[model samples]
Target: MLSNTDIAELLARQAERESGILSRAFRRAARSAFLWPEEVANVIAQNRSLTELRAIGPFIERQIRHWIDKPPHSTHRAPTIRRDFVSLAKARQLLARKPAWAKILRGDLQMHTRWSDGSGTIAEMADAATDRSYEYIAITDHSKGLKIAGGIDEQALKKQGNEIGKLNAFLRKSGRNLLVLRSVEMNLNRRGEGDMSPESLLALDLVLGSFHSSLRIVEDQTNRYLAALRNPHIQILGHPRGRIYNFRIGLSADWPRVFAEATSLNKAMEVDCYPDRQDLNIDLLKIAREHGTHISLGTDAHHPWQLEFIELGLAAALKAKLPADRIVNFMPIGELKSWVREVRGRAPRRP
Candidate 1:
C-alpha cells in the first residue's frame, strides 16, 4: 500500500538511523542542497526493512570517511549477557562459534539513563547502542515513586519526552539504525501496584511494571501480582517473581496460575536477564514455553551499557531449548504491536 517514494523515505530514515557517519555526511551534503549522493547507501541499509533486517547482508557496508566537527563525548556501550554456562572471560569465544547467539544479543533492547539512574543521558545511551549495531532502544527511566532514582513527575514527563524526541532526531541525523521509544520502568510499590496512574501509564510508548520493594511479602504477593496483570498498561510483568539468584529472597510465584493468567490475559512474563539477579528461572521459562505464554526477555538494565543482556536470555532459552516462535517481544515490531493490541481489552489468550 506504500508508494515507492514512501518506501525510499522510510529506507532513508532507516539507513540514516543505522549509520551515523553516513547520516552526518548525507545531512551535511544535504545542507548544501536538498539531497546527497550518500543517500544511496541509506537505501541499501533500508534493504533490511523489507527482509526484517536479514536483508542487510554484511557485504553491503559502505565505508564513509568523516571527521566530527564536534566529536561525541562517549560511545554507546554494548551489554553482553554471558551464557550462564560460560564465564565472562570465555563468552566471546563461545559467542564466536555460535552465530545464532550473536543475533540474540543484537536484538532490540530497553535501558535506563541518568534521566533516571543511568550513567548518561538518553542521547548518549542511544548513540552507544547504535554503535553496537542494535536495531532499537527504549528509554525507560524510572517513573515517580523511587525518588532516589530521580523518578519523573508529570511536568518532568513532558520534558523527558521532549528530550527523547531530540535524541531520536539526533539518531535521524546520524542515519544510523536506531529507534527511540518513550517508556518507563514503573515500580510495583508496597501494595504490589504500579506507581503510575492509568493516565500516566498510557502516555508511554512502552511500559514495564517492576517490583523493587516489599518482595518479601509471601502472603499478598500473588494477589498483588494479579493486580498488576489485570492492568492493560502493565505489559510485561518485570521479573515476575523478584528473585535474586541464591542470595536474597524471591517472590513465591504460583506458576500454573501465573502462566495461565499470562496466556489468558495476553500479559507477558518477563525473563529479566540481569546476572546474580535473574528472576523467572529456567524452570519457569520451560513452563512458559510449554504453555504457549508469550515471553519477553528484558535487561532491566539500570545503566545504558547493560542493554545487551539478551545473551543471558538466549543462554537461558537455549538451556531450556526454547524455539524462536514463542518469543513475543522479539517478534517484528508490527506483529508485537498487534499481539499487544489483542491482549488489551480481551479475555486471557488461554485458560
Candidate 2:
C-alpha cells in the first residue's frame, strides 16, 4: 500500500517532470505531505475527502485517489534534499508507542512573536502554551541582523522583554502554570559571531544562535560549528544544519567533531520541529546521541497552533535513543533555568 512518504516522493517526481501551475501544485502537495496527520491510504480506507489534507485540491485529489486505488510498485527513494524527514503521521505513531516520553517535555524552547515575523501576539502565544500546559517557552524571535525576517534590535528586544515581563506577571496572577522566557534567535556571521551586542544578550534568559547567511556553501563547516559552540553568549545552536527540504541541503560538517564540540561546551543543538526545517535530522542526531550532546526541541513556531510540531522532534529524539536527561526540554522549570544560568556562568566575561 502507498504511504504518505511514497505519495510525497511520487508528487515530487511529478513536479520535476512537469512545469508551471501543475508542477507547482505537485510540489506544494509534496511538501504538505509531511504535515498531513494521516496516511492518504488510511484516509481513503475511511472514505474521507482528500481535500481535507493541506495543499490538496480536486485535481491533485483525483490523481492521489487513483494512486491509492491502484498502489504503485517500485517507488523510488526520496532524493537527498527530501530525504530522512519524518511525516507528522509517522511521528505520532512513533510517539504513541511510548506515551511517557512526550509527557516529559516541560516546555518549548524556540518560538516567534509579533516582535518579529510571527503572526501571534505574546498573549496569544501564552494562551496556546497554557492550553498545552507548558511550564515555560522561549520567545526566540529573530535578531536585528536578519532583516528579511523582521528581526528585532536591542532596543526592540528591551521593549519585548518588558512585554514578556508583563505577560509572565499576568500568568502568575491568573494562576497559570506557564512562563514565557525572554530569548532571541540571534543570527551568526560566518565567523560564528553574533549580530546582537553581547551586553544586550546578557538580559535574555536563553540564547539560540543560528546562521542565516552563506548557507549554500558545500564546504565543511566544522570550524564554523565549533566557533558557534564556543560562543559564550550562545547556549543552543538552532537548526544546526540549516537544511530546508527540497530547497537547500544545508552546510556540510564533520558530524562527530561538531557534536563533540557542543558536548564539551555543554551547549545544545536544536531539532527545529517546523515540518520543513527538521534540521539535525535523525542521522546527525544519532551522532549527537553518541557524543552525549544536549538536545533542545523547538517548534520554531510562527503561530500558536504550530506548537504541535514539537512532536516531530520528540519522535526524532526517541528514535535516536537520546537519553531523557540530555534533553533540555525534559528538565523541570527550575532545573532548566539553572542549566541556562550555569551555561552563562561558564562564559568568559567580555572586557
Candidate 3:
C-alpha cells in the first residue's frame, strides 16, 4: 500500500503539470500530506473518503484515488525543499523496529509557551509533557532579538524563570517527576552575535542560539556556523540551516567542516523536528553521524500537542544510524545537565 508520502509526491508532480487554482490546490494537498495523521491507503482500506484528510476536496480526493489505484512512476528527483521529510505515519513505522529507542527519550530540548508565540502556557505545556512521560522539557522561548516573534527581554526571562520554578515545585509536590528547564532561543545575527546579554544567558539552565535573519542568502555559511558554535552563551545551535519545506532552500555550506567544529566544541546542532522545518535533515545528519557530532532533537513546538513532532527527528536520526550515545535526548536529566555544564565551562568569558 502507498504511504501518504507516495500520494503527496503524486499530487506534487500533477501540480507541476497544471496552472491556476487547480495547480495551487494540488501543491497544498502535497504539503498537507506531512500533517495528515493516517495513511491514505489505510483510509481507503476502511472504505473511507480521501476528503477526510487535510487539503483534500472531492476533486483532489478523486485524483488521490486514481493514484492509489495506479501509482504514478516518479521519473525525476524531488527538489531539496520537498525531499527527505518523514511523515508521522512513516516515523511510527521506523520506530516500531526498535521499540526501545522511543522509550529512552527523557525530554524535549526545545519548545515555547505563551511567553512567546506559542499558544499554550507553561502549565499547559508541562501537562502535555507529563502525558508523554518526559522527565523534563526545555522552555526555549524567543529572546529579545526576535521582536517579530514577541521575544522576551532579560527581565521577562527572569520572571519566566520564577514561574518555571513554581511549576517545578508544584509538580514535585504532586509527585510528578517533570522539570521545566529554563532556556531561550537567543537570536543570532549574521555575525553570530546573540541579542541577549551574556550574563542573562548564563542564568538559564541551557541556551540555544539560532539565526533568525539572513537565512535566504544563497552563499556559503560555514563561517557563520563556526562563529555561532564558538559563542560562549549557546550550548546548542537551533535549526542550523533555517530551511522551510517547499519555500526557503536554506543555506549552503561545507557541512563536514561545520559538523567537525561542532564535534570538537562538544556543542550540538539541533534536529528541529517541526514538519515544515526539519533542518539537519537525513543527508546532513549522515555527515554529522560520520563526524560523531552531538545531535540534539527538538520539536520546535509552538503548541503543546505538537511535541509529537519529535518522531520525525527521531526517525531521521534512526535512518542516519546516529549512535544513541551522541544523541543528547537519550541522556537522563542529570547527564543532560552535565553535558550543558561542560560545554558552558569551556566557552570563553565575555567582556
Candidate 4:
C-alpha cells in the first residue's frame, strides 16, 4: 500500500516530467497530500472517488488511480522542503497511540482574527475555541510591518486589545473558561529587530516574532536566530525555518547553536501547524529535544475551524519525544501566562 508520503513523492516526480498548468496542479496535489485527512488508497478501497481528497479532481483522480494500480518507481528524492511532514492520517494514528496527549493540550498559542488577515471575527474564533474546550487562544495577528498580510499598527493593536478585554469579561461572566490572549505576530528584520514599538508590544499578553522577508537567502542564518532570541520583545520565535512545502526550502543555520541559545534564554520556538508550513518539523525538533529547548505549538490559524491543525504540531512534538514540561501549550492558561511573564521578565530592559 502506498502511503501518503509515497503518493506525494510520486506526484511530485510526475510533475517534474510535465510542464505548464498540469505541472503546477500536480505539485499542488503533492503538497495537499500531506493535508489529506485520509489515505487515498482507503478512499479508493471504500469505493469512494479520489476527488473527495483535497487538490484532487477527475483528472488528478485518474492519475492517482494509475499510480495506485501500477506503483511507479519514484525518481524524486525527498528534498528538504518536502521531508518529514506528517499526513493528517498519520497524525491521527500517532495521537491514537497516546490517546491522552491531545487531551492535555490547554490552548492554541497562535492564531488570527479579522483584526488582521483572518477570515473570522474575534467572537467567532472565541466561540470556536469554546467548542474545542480550549482554556485560551492567542490572537497573534500580523503586526504593522507586514502590510501584505494587512498587519495591524500599534493603534489598531490597542483597539484589538479592547475587543479582547470585552470578550474576556463576557466569557468570565458567562462562566466559560476560555480566554483570548492579546498578541501579535510581530515582523522581525534580518537584524533581529522588530517592526513594532516596545511600548506597544508590552501591552499585549504575549508576542510572537517571525521573519516575513528575505527568506530565500542561502547563507547560514545562525547570527540572525541568535539575535532574534536575544531581542526582548518576543517570547516565542514563530516558524523558525521560514519554509513552505514545495515552494520555499527555508533558511539554513547552525541549528544546534540556535537551539542552545533558545534553551539558555528560556525562550520557545514554534511548530507552526499550518499543513504546508509545519516549521520546526520532527527532524529539527529532535535536535531541540537534545538541547532541552522549549517547543511551542501554533496552528498559525487564520480562521476558527483551522484550529484542528494543532494535531499536526502535536503529532510532530510527540514524534520528536519532547518532554511534556518543555512544551508550552501543554500548560494551563494561568501557568502559560506565567511562563510568558517569566520569559518577558528576562528580556533586556528597554532603553
* Among all candidates shown, the one with the greatest TM-score: 2
- Badly placed stretches (over 4 Å) of model 1 are 1-98, 104-109, 190-192, 345-351
Using lDDT, give the best candidate's number: 2
Candidate 3 has a TM-score of 0.95
- Clash numbers, per candidate: 15, 0, 0, 0
Worst 10 residues of 1 by lDDT: 78-87
lDDT-superior candidate, 2 or 3: 2
TM for every model, in the order presented, reads 0.68, 0.99, 0.95, 0.97
Ranking by lDDT: 2, 4, 3, 1
15 in model 3: Cα distance from truth in Å? 4.2
> What tens digits encode model 1's per-residue C-alpha lDDT throughout 2-26?
2222222333333456667655443
Quantify all predictions' global Cα lDDT against the true fold. 0.60, 0.93, 0.91, 0.91
Please identify model 2 stretches exceeding 4 Å from their true place. none
Error of model 1, residue 140, in angstroms: 1.5
- In model 3, where do residues sit more than 4 Å from their true spots? 14-24
Candidate 2: lDDT over CA atoms? 0.93
TM-score, ranked from best to worst: 2, 4, 3, 1
lDDT of 2 by residue, 1-351 (tens): 887888888899889999999999999999999999988888888989999999999999999988877777767788899999999999999999999999999999999998899999989988999899899999999999999999999999999999999999999999999999999999999899998988889999999999999999998999999999999999999999999989999999998999998998899999999998998899999999999999999999999999999999999999999999999999998898899999989899767
Residue 216's lDDT in candidate 2: 97
